[model samples]
Target: MNPSPPLAPGLPVLGNALRMMGDVQQFLVDTYRQMGPVYRVRALNQAFVIMAGERANRFLLERGDEVFSSEVSFGGLNSEFGMRVHVLRGRPHRHLRKVLATGLSRDLLAARWDDVTAATERELAQWRGQRALPVVDRCQRLAAAQLSVAFTGANSAARFATLRSAFELVLDVTIAGKWPAAALKLPAYRRARAEILAFARSCLAERAAHPTGGPADLLDRANEAKDENGNPYPLEVRAGMALQGYFAGINTVAYLYSFMMYALARHPDVRARVLAEVDAAYDGDRLDFERLRGLPALHGLVLETLRVYPPAPGSARTVLEDFDFEGFRIERGKRVLVATSVPHQLAEHFPEPELFDIDRDFAAGRRASVYAPFSVGSHTCLGAGMTEVLAVATVAMMVRRLTVTAPDRPLRITATPGPNPGRRFAVTVAGRPKI
Candidate 1:
């Protein structure tokens, strides 16, 4: 029998909680480097097997569905939103993913380009000539606003604060694990959840009222969705599923968009390259997904930024049974942290990974084993393709029409549960500097 993974140094019941609480991505990356691919971390009563690097990623991701369960780990999060995609396992999960594919497809994203740009432009309009705009807050508002229009066809600007507060509180308790499970019992959380549900219901009702003869959105497809048995999903399930985009994204999108914008601001050369590509790629007012494929610098910048600043810590899953890999054992019901982005910053795979160089050849070592920014295998992010497309296109829009800058300041990241641009990351914006 192989020995259990070594436990990281920790104090008393707190274990690694203190260090893990701040900058989880960097802490995990640094831990993966100092402690090998497999190790154990404890926080009070909770314990997790930290797995990273290529071999661990292969064993965990490629065989994740069989050996691990998402619902087991994050059922609480899923339950709050009443969505199954974030919690369900195996066949049922695949079926739901297929059902929702129509909404998440590239074609749908292309169709929603106008709304995407409109939301972004609206938010940036407020930032124009503003002193010290909070990038994370602005990006969160912008991302959520676009998510509202693109996903549910809802104009959510007025309810943006409620939406942000609700989603942020839920993630803090759930995926972020920053708040205790009992945090959900607080009046603030309850109110937030109620508002989210109410908002979801309104989207459903609006979609039902005007079924067709409009640009198709997430709610439209979901409203028509039949489950695996070719029967309509229950109204409750449909309602939950309608807000899946907001439930699963928003924060991640906000952080990602925030990081990309910061990267463009910090790297003038890269910014110029991305701006030039965006300037030429536009076909009048229409710059769709396909149009972005030819822009190497812009695409590379997005990938590089994600590699550097992974929004969330890592994919969370709970082991279903006792298992051993890499000469170590993980017990049944043990929480597992698959640090998928570990390799994203690993020197062996990325060579001077700290340096931001977008033009580097990525295809050479782009296999899932070595680089999984969105994770790998069965539960790979459903919106991965669309998310990438959105990143590429949205960054283009930012550089083309706005200038965001912070003089004599370097990027700083704060992790409430996962990393985000820190307060000092505030930037001043002046509208559309000459390209």
Candidate 2:
């Protein structure tokens, strides 16, 4: 068999771990340049083929389950989070996915637009009154609260609030690996998991008690969903799905929301144009899905933000069989990563890739397919449509109701649950007009 892609040179024993941890995006970029699309880098004491570019991404994401194992790739997360929705494959995955789809359906999200808008407005209102705080932290908390309400109805706010820090700790563990993860799993993390289970059990009980009287929410959708044989999902499965969706949704969308707003504040002229669109869409009164949908600038801004700052920048898959990938003979059981951020920055794919321009026409041609921020195919983000709506609504409301300016201190990207501001940076917000 042809040798696996060239192994990246690294320090004795440690391999490329330091480089990978130092600056993951840059390491991927630099390695791709020196070694081309396929190369091997070691992390956590194991070697993985680092695959870059849109073609590689499409290959891994689209046809992954056929030859690459999601369970093997994502199973590490289960140590802390339990059997999350992403870890399943084959029939079980399909069944869980079907249930999740119903809850995150466009119809459901549209029906819940009022809650989304109200959440955005409430967060912005708080920001307007505050003197200073890390906008990223505040945005994350807002996203968690909003998603909690959407998932389990209004009563879930306090429970979700309690779970947020523990959720953060879990994310840390998932990224840090077995030893570090084990060491970090303190009482707080256990408490958080217990609280989540308790809250989920309560939701299950609530759904059973009022099968029809309660307001429609994610739990209701999960309760009503069926497996391949038409059996409703077990309470444990439903609860797991709810918790999984909450963790993924809040973490990714929260950073994205802050990033988009950060972009708007950094670019005043673009902000002015976007705010104009938001105001025009609002017309005089309430903001609904119809109005929000019509705001082209806001939609463009959201897309632009995702392209620049994908929350899940890289996705991994474990090879199930020996295979030829791009003329390289990859062996069975080897893990490979589809380095999305590399292609996202390729000069050919996006000219002057570093520039943040909202006017980029992403709807047509290669740009559309090339942009895989939320990934594509079977593992594509289920909440994509909802996230787009929330990102637009939240940013638009912030701009329309308040003037947001970036702090003098540069905001550096760092991983909290995902890539976010290295430290909390103040974004000054003052009233624009009473909404």
Candidate 3:
């Protein structure tokens, strides 16, 4: 057996927990800096090896899916959402993945463009007289509005709001981990979870009574889907899928929209370039989906934002069997955490990685393995197409309606599990005539 690499020293009892709790990303980055590309840390009775850089990211993402498993990484989620047979590995997982992919197809996303644009316009109009909006909250509402219309139907606006609020509670608690988990047993968390579950079940019941006839919403489709054995997924399976989709789509979209807007506000030159592109593309009417996709600069801007501030900072996997890497052994059953932020900052893949350059031209025909924003391989984000659509639509709509100016003080960001600008960002919007 190959020998293991040196493990990072840790405090007794708490191990590295306190160090990680201080500033998680920085702690991980610092550990990587000291221990090289791979190092192990013990925290809360669990030991995890963190791998950094592009090459290491590729190896972990590609190989780990087959050998290691997301079962442990996603354990917290599974506990919260319940172990839906559909979301687990094997044939059921494949069937559900295929069904979910159908909703995010290019054609389907194009069909939903009207819903997205309409939501954006309506939300922006509400902000007409407002100044210094808490961009995170506003963006979450906006994303919820769009996702509700696209996933469920236009009538789900109120329900989506409730769901969004519930998810925010869940996310806030989960981000706090052990502390919040204990606290969550209190009345508020129970009430929120119960209400959200009830709302989801009610929606499912309504859909069952009256089908959309056309392509049904994801919840309805999953409920109606039959495997090769010709058995419909159980209700818990349906609920699990719905909850997963809700959490997956809403939070990430909100963060991306807020960050992109904040980035534009801070960088006027980039904003101007984006606006010019959008203006040139407009045909005196609605923004065409095809035209939006054609804007590589806008795409690059979104990509760069993700590279700089990835939503899921790290991914975890448990090694199923012993593996040798660069003359070191990774023992079986050991957990490995791949630091996504580190690879995104590596100079080898992204020179001058700190600078935000939308015209970088790094993404064109580049190997998919290099980028880990949405990750790579089987478990890559299913909402990727939807995210792109939302990002472009959000940026385009904001640019068309307002000239965003940064606040007196630069916005501070909290690099929690997801990156969000601190509580408030002040921006002034100079309006333009409606199209």
Candidate 4:
């Protein structure tokens, strides 16, 4: 009989949790080097069999839903995000995704272009004359302000802070692990969650009263949704679902926007290319989706940033059935981790993987196995298409008018449970010199 897959040895009781906490991507890479592609690591009393490299990522992300389950893998999410569409599995997931497609579709994004562009312009204007500001912090606030209005019709300045706080606290809770995160049970986090729920509740009530015309926010779309059985979801579920979308939209977009900005600051040659493309793409005073797509430099910058530092570096799926993986007999109930960061960095796929090359040919099929910032298959990110458009537009808006410079110290990229610019990464944004 073939021996079981190797288990990564770690300190007693603590297991690999400490290393994982210290540096998730590096720890995974080290473990892979020491124990081959398949290995198990115990963390916080749970064991996870990690699969590394392109093939492993493909298998874990693309396998049949009958065998692997996202709901089980990310069980921690339901407690926080509720059983929203992102956490749904099987038929429920499929149906919800279909319903959400209407909201997240490209057409909806195109229609909302003016507001999103205007929001980014305002934030960029605010950034000017700043001495030094943490890119992540500013980006999160800007993203929250933009999305809160776009997603929930909360356009008040006060509402932006509340929404931003709620999303950030929830993300912090997710990072701190369930028990400790629960134990601490900070009142601020509690208050934020309550506010989020309340806000969601208000949106639902308003949607119900109108039931016809209003801003094309997320709640509006969700309010109009019907399940496969032609039944409307409960008000609470719709609220929860809309809240989850707000949390996801605000948080993930903040990270993506920050990373793209950070990349432009750190890489001057690439920055020049992006500025050139932005200038050439927009001669008109008004910006639109078509104008945004005309920016190949900014588009490539977004893709390269995602490849280098995906907001979420890894994805997990809990095995529901016994399966054979590379000669090793894996058992059910075990969580399978697919390292997205590792595959993106693999020398086999990306030559000189360490270098930040913005001009790489992403159109070719090479990205299929090597790049998956949004994961793949049935559980792929519902906002994938919209996210691409938003990222491009936001970056273009900034690069078109401003020049961002990184601090003298090399900007550090670390994960605050997700890839983020470390505390010291502050960039100075100033108006571009007129040419």
Candidate 5:
């Protein structure tokens, strides 16, 4: 076997793990600057080949089946969570994605707009009399409420705290790295896992008991769906899917919403433009799905937010077999992480990548392969359409309902490992004056 490439030097066994822990994005940018697109890095005594740049990202996301596989990359997930949908690949993978796509199509999403709008309005009403509300927390609750309505037709405000806790537990476990194995092995991890699974099971049971065929939520639809082989998805599989769906939908939507509000507060010009677009699109009333879709500037703003602060900064793929890319041999079984941060900011793909210009023509059609906030290929995010709708609605509602002003200090973005904002902003929202 060809020897693995050398990593940029680091201390002892820990390697560059400490630096990565401090700030993953900046660490990656530094690495790319030093070693170019493809280099090696060591973490937890494991040597991983790191790749960046547009071509590298394309190869990692698109060529997973032939050259690499998510199964290999996300092995830790299976070992911890026991072969959930996120770890499935090959034919089984294709089947699961198809079933998910059926429920998340554009028409189905359009049909569900009323549920989303109602939930958003309900949540916003609670924030009316409060000062110094944690914007991140508020956005999270709003997104969770909308997701609950879409996922299970349940009222989320009462259960938001529990659901949010469960979701955070799962996320914490997944991103713990190798050091937290002891803690994860303890009853805490197991208990959290049990809580999430138990919640899913109850939801599945309820959906099974009342199987609504016409315009039902995600759970109801999944309960009705069956594979070509006539096999219904197992309860565990369904639960896993539900858990993953909530995780995918809630965190990113909330963060993007907060960022949009922050941008509106800071940039009056952009705020005025967004407000004008919302007014023209909806005539200062409820946001219909069709109207939201027609607002191109709103769409551009959300995309730009994602480009600057992707929910998941990097993605990993493990080589299933020896593959040669541009003359470098990637050995089998070695993990390869593609830092998506720098590539999305590449000048070749996005001109003046630093500037937050929503009007930049990202692409003529929706299928901008290079713009991968939802990722691409088989493992692409199943809830992309739903997420986009939720974000657009949340931003539009805030723009229409209140005038947001930033705090006295510049907004401090707490860069958690995920794209979550660490420090919540306190926005002062006054009632919109009559136009």
Candidate 6:
């Protein structure tokens, strides 16, 4: 058997823990570059084996199901947020994914396009009298608006307000495993989980009460989906699916939309091209799915934004079976940190990787195994198609109806929950007249 992966340089007992304290993604990338494909590092008491780089990422993505167990790895999140698609394995995972697909699938993104646009317009309506507004917060509001209406028929900001903050609390405790297990039992966590569960159940009840009207929402679709044996999922299962679809897509899309807007603001050349393309694609006031899919400049801008400012970059997995990667042995049941985005930052995949240029061709990266903005393999994001539609359509709508401008300065980014524009990353937004 091949020997274990080499150990990374670290201090006495703490190991590489101190280094990871600041910018976890950066630390992962830098470590992969220095230590090669596979290596080990410790955080205070526990040592985690990290497999990354281009070759390693491809291997993990192609064979992840055989060797890595997401359900075991994300146990903390599962216990806190309850079982969702991200925490299920094998057939159960695929079954729930099918239920989630009832709402998040590509076909629905077009059929339910009105719902998405309505949410955008509603949130944009609220931003009429605002300036220098923290775009991240507003983006979160926008995302919550779409996800809320899409998951349930509810679109009121006041109703989503509590669910938004409660879900944020859930991520805080479980995102990076920063807190100990006892933290899960805190009054704050208890309250947060209760609020989230309560929100899901209330939406389910409301949908059951008035199931006949409006566009088909996630709850409606999930409720109609049958299991492998042709039986409808139970209430608890449906609730979890809705919660997963609703809460899972919010922050990622929020961060993405915020960055896409900022990328437009910060780069004038790209902005001009995107504006021209969006203007040409509109058939009067409507943008059909066909035209939406055909905007190369806007599509490039979205892809570039994800390449540089990926929200949910790396995923943690527990090794399910012993495997050798790049001549290093990964033992079963040990938690492994997979740096899925390492390739995005690598010059080999994206030339001048740090620069945010929408002009770069992503064909090669797509052909290779380098790009994974929505993650990779079986657990790839269910809302990816919707996310694209949201980014493309919302940006186009804002460009048409809202005067949005950010400071001609560098963006201040943070990665607590995920990479986000700082609170001060505000834009000047106001209503614009349409011709």
Best model number under lDDT: 1
lDDT of 6: 0.76
Provide the clashing-pair count of each candidate structure.
0, 0, 0, 0, 0, 0
TM-score for every candidate vs. truth? Answer: 0.94, 0.91, 0.87, 0.90, 0.88, 0.90
Candidate 2: stretches off by over 4 Å: 10-15, 44-46, 76-84, 175-181, 212-216, 365-368, 408-410, 433-435
For model 3 the TM-score comes to: 0.87
Query: Model 3 segments beyond 4 Å from truth?
Result: 1-3, 8-30, 42-47, 82-87, 155-165, 168-180, 364-368, 408-411, 430-435
- Measured on C-alpha atoms, candidate 4 has an lDDT of 0.71
Residue-level lDDT for 252 in candidate 2: 85
Q: For all the candidates, what are their Cα RMSDs to the real structure?
A: 2.0, 2.6, 3.1, 2.7, 3.0, 2.6
Clashing pairs in 5: none
Candidate 6 pairs with clashing backbones: none
Cα lDDT of candidate 5 equals 0.68
By summed lDDT, which 10 consecutive residues of candidate 6 come out lowest? 172-181
Model 6 ranges off by over 4 Å: 10-22, 44-46, 213-216, 229-232, 430-435
lDDT of 2: 0.71
Per-residue alpha-carbon lDDT of candidate 5 for residues 62-170, written as tens digits (9 for 90 to 100): 6767766666545555554433556777887788777766655556556666876788888887776566778888888888887766666665566566566545544
List the candidate 5 regions with Cα displacement exceeding 4 Å.
1-3, 9-15, 43-47, 72-83, 176-179, 364-368, 408-417
lDDT, candidates in the order shown? 0.78, 0.71, 0.69, 0.71, 0.68, 0.76
Better of 1 and 2 by TM-score: 1
Candidate 6: tens digits of C-alpha lDDT, residues 84-162: 5777778877887877777776665666677778878878887775777788888888988877665665664675666
Q: Which is better, 3 or 4, measured by lDDT?
A: 4
Off by over 4 Å in 1: 283-290
- Looking at model 2, which ten-residue stretch has the lowest summed lDDT? 170-179
* Model 2, span 292-351: residue lDDT tens: 778888888888888777776677777888877777888888877878767767788777
lDDT of 3: 0.69
Off by over 4 Å in 4: 9-14, 44-46, 81-83, 152-157, 168-181, 184-187, 211-217, 365-367
Better of 2 and 6 by TM-score: 2
